[model samples]
Target: MSFLKKLKEKISKQTDTVTEKFKHGLEKTRNSFADKVNDLVYRYRKVDEDFFEELEEILIGADVGVSTVMELIDQLKEEVQRRNIQDPKEVQAVISEKLVGIYKGDSEFSNEINMQEDQLTVVLFVGVNGVGKTTTIGKLAHKFKSEGKSVLLAAGDTFRAGAIEQLEVWGDRVGVEVIKQGSGSDPAAVMYDAVQAAKARKVDVLLCDTAGRLQNKVNLMKELEKVKRVIEREVPGAPHEVLLVIDATTGQNGLSQAKTFREATNVTGIVLTKLDGTAKGGIVLAIRNEMDVPVKFVGLGEQMDDLQQFDPEQYVYGLFANLVETEEV
Candidate 1:
């Protein structure tokens, strides 16, 4: 009846490959974060004030966000008093349980992409440059294509030099057509063209790429507003998903970018890239708890198929795979 046991049973029903990916991708965080917790538990056999303080520091070190760490620590204290727990080892499962709880909270948000039942599904990708925005789009296009859905790419990043060609390269690699205009052309115009082409070709999904310039917030907001306006006018309820891509390696700076984009446009979901490359995977919790926006997908590895839909259970399992497998019910 332990929380870890329940998690093991729940994860057992899912695909083993996915679980393994989570385990492997989270190795860095586990080695840095979970391993430290294991050491803390070993060094302090009894749960006490000092023990909780050290644990708080560990959670904060993992980039769990200061406020969230405080909240989690307070909950742990209440749970300890309520259950009269004395062993530090017994707190591991509670930590895992609380992490999943914090991510889910009271909301019933679904992480799935919002695809149209019988019409073209438009997904707009937004992020500052060098955050792997283009690559995420390519990977997503590949994902949709692998699902037997006809996909199209709209090169709306006309402001950046070679942005169109970059998207085209991905288009060719994925064997999908790219709708683009010449460099320095208006991005809104490119979107207009892409929308028309997607409708004409009747593609199942259209992934639109936009300029990632954050040099001026006013310009960024104006440009995104214009692009969104064109899409809405062309196809009602279009641009169904505006996914903000962030590099996990950047840590807190990534969260800052999320806030900026959320202000400029309505970011429906987040696509966290380079998750395997960071030791602070705890940013996932900070984003969800603080921003209230769901992380729809995460880049677990460098492989094309490593971009996966976010699952809180699998994520916690990944963070404590070693301990979860060895713990007794």
Candidate 2:
């Protein structure tokens, strides 16, 4: 088969079964977003000013950022004019292509964790307390362990009561060792110890959970800096990935949280949690468009395997499965 055909087949297979996580996780978004688009196309058979206006509304309402919506609309206009298309229904495919393009802007798309080949890879988790930060760390540990890599968890979230215990619980569940200190201890100290232990044991990955206190950005920044310094001091060029976890159900508020967290530290990627719980999955587009950070992982369900790497093709197919089928027909 030709490369394009093969690629489409792969994406189709993924949407059919391989990407059931995204398909099921994005069910709410598919229903709401697809319904709105289908309705709009049905209402306006001809592409006109009103169609563009309604399309903008739908995109914005789907939690696509205003800036992203504007850019998309502009691109849509250009595509429509360039293609000389008149049917709004025919524009659906173009819209999907554009949406995916927005996320891929100028750079290669990737969801892979940047792990060191021959050394310990440290991932520092950061976000506000209630955004599933600890849970993400645990889930990631499980994933890394399942991959046959020696994984360790560092309970560096010393500020929250029971934070250390929670990470330890996850460590126990995943059959990995957890390095921790008492609650309210210096988070940097925990990181220091974790790095030393990881190096000593020849661990493959070290997942660190840090305090989620974001009320005071200055304090949080300082604390994170100290932790980062300690990790680098122990192992130069450590903390391979600083992942920012966000609750997908938070809608646009999640975007706001991302902006704040990015300002506080260098966030390499995003982990969107609770994706199955919200109808505002369009926030994914807004996130990549506005924040320019790749979404590393998405939480689809409560199962250990629900946290899958983000795939743009699968995501687009999942979101617009019905629309794509209709277009093919």
Candidate 3:
């Protein structure tokens, strides 16, 4: 069976609500990227050098990253040559398959949160200001609460004005408690207190928010290190996951932010926010390929339940949903 058909079948087995979320969230990217690809295939009936070149441009324009686009183009050429594919329409499935391949690479990386069973799971969120870091934390808290897990929020972002209040708002909205301190207090101290509270309360999960100051790399690194040290000292093998939240609409700039945050701390995964706001959703592939970090969650929309776990198959299905539904097995 064809790859698109296989993906269609797989998605069909999943919850209809989740599949529809992916499809609707990716509407912008689909209307831009997939439409162009379809038009390109129609304009060129046969796969050839010129066809590949135009496809390359389309991928690049979709913010797939130049290096990744080049690699994908090369892979497509080889696949076409090996399969002796002449019809340009046949390459669409190949493109989707290669996209999933590039995102997954060679390993089967799990995108689920690394929760500690029978113990408190500490998830530290780090990213620049205005990247929707706090919002993602709120949504994630809601998700855990919906799953019947006890969750606590730690407001460690003391530097940013109203940061604590913002987190408190989310905490109230989600019905989760927020542990915070007065503004201008040391962030490490806040983490220390938060850890103690979590331990006393026996919370299942604690999501900590940090200040997003990137003007000085050294200060940011030091602050994060100190916060991490406090968490480690309080709970052995804690801070289970350091998630860097990046705004998907920022495109390549988001990749640069990931590099900075990755250097500041051990970023186990990423939370790409505002994905539905951008037409070039290919930034997902660029981030996975370039950063070598799995995107654990994606902010599909503004709704509280829109923060969904990252699934490559569902993502590809979202990108090509129109074609997938219309294609024959």
Candidate 4:
């Protein structure tokens, strides 16, 4: 089949049993929001003033951000005028295409695991609670191991209850060894241990799981900086990547999280969770457009395979594909 069709089928196969979890969350997104837009479409046969007003609200509400939404609406308006469009469904298609144009215009994002020079590559995951940080680590480790690499996990999320065990759970699921220090333990101490172990054992990748801080941004930044410093002291440029994981379902709040984390630590990339959800999926653009961070991964389901590298072209197209679906609620 076609590339897009093949990808959709693959995602369908992987998420078939649990796509509802994806559908349920996405169906509730406030952007290009369903309630009013669907209602407006059913009411009017063609483009009108009220539709644009409501469409603007839907995009803004879904966390597309005001500026981006304005640009999107303006483009849609131009399309309406140029094509002399009259159908609501057709207009929806136009909206989707414009969104696809946002991030995937010319560049394609690489999702492959990159190797380092002398030692194994190390990635440190950072994010707030409930952003799927631990789960992403497990999935990423599985991804690397699938590529014929020795992987080890360091559970440094010692502050939260069951955080270390949670990482262990992933390690167990993936059949990889987990180096962990217990809860209330020094996070830096855990990283030091993980670093030293990875060096001697010569694992391909070392993933450090950190606690999700509900505290102030400075405190969080300081805590992450300490972890990096400790790892560097032990392994020297040890943590090769600092990835910030965000829940896409959280919408614009995800962008704010990126900003804070970027300031706190050098967030080299982002992993967007809950992409299957209906949160407009526009936050991906907002992240790239505003913060200039390349989105590395996107979580589409609960399974390990659900977390895949963020392909701007495929994702940009997929986000709007639902708009063209014949099925209607």
Each model's lDDT: 0.92, 0.87, 0.94, 0.76
What is the C-alpha lDDT profile of model 2 across 147-218, one tens digit per residue? 899998999988888888888888889999999888888999989999999999999999999998878889
Residue pairs clashing in model 1 are none
The most accurate candidate by TM-score is: 3
Off by over 4 Å in 4: 1-48, 79-89, 105-108, 233-238, 277-280, 322-329
Candidate order by decreasing lDDT:
3, 1, 2, 4
lDDT of 4 by residue, 1-329 (tens): 33334445555655444444444434445234655566667778678888899888877766778877787889889988998988875675566567656665455544554569667788999999888899999998898889888999999888888888888889999989999876788888988899889989988899989988957777787889899999888877767788999988888888888998888888888899887665567688788767767888878877777786666545533544454343432
Scanning candidate 4 in windows of ten residues, the lowest lDDT window is 320-329
In terms of lDDT, the best-performing candidate is 3
State in Å the error of residue 134, model 3. 0.8
Per-model TM values vs. the true structure: 0.98, 0.95, 0.98, 0.80
Model 3 Cα shift for residue 246 (angstroms): 0.4
Determine which window of 10 residues in candidate 3 has minimal summed lDDT: 320-329
Task: Give the local distance difference test score of model 3.
Answer: 0.94
Give the per-residue Cα lDDT of candidate 4 at 223: 85
> Order the candidates by TM-score, highest first — what do you get?
3, 1, 2, 4
lDDT (Cα) of model 1: 0.92
How many residue pairs collide in each prediction?
0, 0, 0, 4
